[model samples]
Target: MRYFIHLAYDGTAYSGWQVQPGVPTVQEALNTALSNVLRQSVRTQGSGRTDAGVHASHQVAHFEADFPPEMTLDLLRYRLNRALPPDVQVFRIHEVDERANARFSAEARTYEYFVRLRPDPFRRDQALYLDRGRPDVGAMNVAASYLVGQFDFTAFSKVKGAETHYICCLYEAGWHETAEGLVFRIRANRFVRGMVRLVVGTLLDVGRGKLTPLEFQQVLHRQQRIAASGAAPAKGLYLSRVEYPAGIVPAADVREPA
Candidate 1:
């Protein structure tokens, strides 16, 4: 049967979501734990990859498994969580249609970038420190507004990306003030490689008076990679959510009794 696994991870300790040679990764940890618990070789596929040092609050992966008749989904989740490391967690496991996929079935993805105006020891690994000065939130929002609607985001994507095209539709994009600092949230139909970090980096330019809002819009229209500023630190970003169509999977719950 096909199953969807809802999970999250703190990416500070691992490479990226995908498995790699020698380097530790979230996928490698998950595959190993699943294999150990199932008592059989198991390979799971993720919804998408988050770069090294990036975090995910919600991620989904799908796999096919044949459990012993006595095993329940809740029991399987508990066992899998026990086998996984502390930094990684499995929140829910349930059966899904064989056609549902963690990646292609997703309708939208949202990412957030955090910046701190003052230093805080606890948030050092989770937010970027910008003690220089508070950025111009007004200017940043003006620049970010251009991101809404469809645009060929070639200017913001990695030059060597494997994607066939650079077109993406943005449902929403904006920066807002938070009690601790500022948060940038963007939701899109799809994203290109290094797209979020790069966008955050360049938008900071506008925030810091380096680029005017109009200039920022012009630069995006130019669609040249070098026209943007350097990419932001990976630690400041998070894959906050992945949305799917209704009935894609069962409703969310803490867990079922085994």
Candidate 2:
């Protein structure tokens, strides 16, 4: 049977999601844990790749397994978590359609970048500390608005390999003040590698008065990576959510495994 695994991980300790020879990764850790519990080899395909040092509050992957009639989803979840490291967790397991894919079936994904204005020892690893001064939040928002519609994100993407297209439909883009600091949340149909970080960095430039909103829009139109600011640090970014069509996961299996 094919199952969807809902998980979260702190990417600080690993080399990102994909497995690499001689290097630790979230996928390798999960594969080992699942294989140990199932007593068979199990491999998972994740929703997307996250760069090193990025965190995920919610992520999904799919794997196939044959189970004896006695096995339960809750039991599987418990065993998987116990076998996995503390930084990675398995929270829910649902029996999905044979054709449902964790990546392609996803309708949208949301990411958030955290920024801390004041020194806080507790959130050092989770948020980016800006010491220059509080950025112009209003200007940042204006810059963010330019990214709300569908556009080719070639200027912001890191071109590692050939891609079919650079188009992405952004549904939401905005920054909001939080008690801890400020948070920038962006939701899109899909994101190319390094897109968010680069966008965030450029917006930060706008907030700092280094780039005007018009220049930011011009960068997008230019379709050149050099025109954008450097990528924001990965530690401040998190894959906050992923949404799928209603039919992808059955209604009865929607809730977290008990």
Alpha-carbon RMSD to native, per candidate? 3.1, 2.4
Give the TM-score of each candidate: 0.96, 0.95
lDDT per model vs. reference:
0.90, 0.90
lDDT of 2 by residue, 12-82 (tens): 98889988899999999999998989889999999998889999888899999997677799999998899
lDDT of 1 by residue, 131-194 (tens): 7998899999989999999999999999898999999999989997889999999999999999
Give the clash total for candidate 1. 0
